[model samples]
Target: MAFHTRSNSFPSMPHPIVQEVDEHLCRLRSSEAASTSSSSICHKLSGLQDLHDCVDKLLLLPLTQQALAKEQNKKWTNELLDGSLRLLDVCSSAKDAILQTKECFGGIHRRKSLPISLLVEE
Candidate 1:
């Protein structure tokens, strides 16, 4: 990446790609700030648990009403009665990804401790 100027704003127009990237970076920084606000992994996992509870509550709602709540996929006709099940699917995928990452790092920590064990044996 190349830094073109002090700012991306132009008199008549803006650089769309740069603007999008900057917005994404800002969001990332905000999320980083939020995640770093709590140092405990347990806290974050508890948050995930809370999300799961919300999902369970959501499950109590009728499928048609649930689909109607999601505006992005709502159609003009009978489909308006339908709910986008994608929300649960996406959330579950994200949860899986987070757990996978935790497992990967846990394995890495165990691997790092192997040398310490070898040192102790020596």
Candidate 2:
């Protein structure tokens, strides 16, 4: 079988999931510097969760599954599968980390009278 390289050009109109992912990423980037409060951090984590959801939707589409299944090259498919798995893993880890941070921060934020050292001692 002959192997042919495909063009990397994107369609004139991006897929809806692609657009969603872009929007979430742009929002996250724009808010990065202004994330000083717990609410802001929660909002950013929500955006990350939205991006992860977009990826999950994209991967589950029949067209995407078919494309991966039909690929003649095992290497490309393997890499794509591996990359997707890694992406999901990172997203899960990030979400958990953010939630833990929010909890700890919120706890300390709620206890305004306590010193930092006192909070740590507890």
The top-ranked prediction according to TM-score is 2
After superposing candidate 1 on the true structure, give the runs of residues whose Cα lies further than 4 Å from its correct spot.
Answer: 1-33, 36-83, 116-122
Q: Single out the weakest 10-residue window by summed lDDT for candidate 1.
A: 76-85
Misplaced by over 4 Å in model 2 are 1-12, 71-122
TM-score of each: 0.35, 0.56
Task: Please give the TM-score that candidate 1 achieves against the real structure.
Answer: 0.35
**Cα lDDT of model 1 by residue, 4-89, tens digit:** 77765544754444454455545444555464422344455455455445444444556635664677644642342232345456
- Best model per lDDT: 2
Give the Å error, residue 62, model 2. 2.2
lDDT of 2: 0.80
> Could you report the Cα RMSD, in angstroms, for every candidate shown?
16.3, 8.0
Error of 2 at 27 (Å): 1.4
Looking at model 2, which ten-residue stretch has the lowest summed lDDT? 113-122
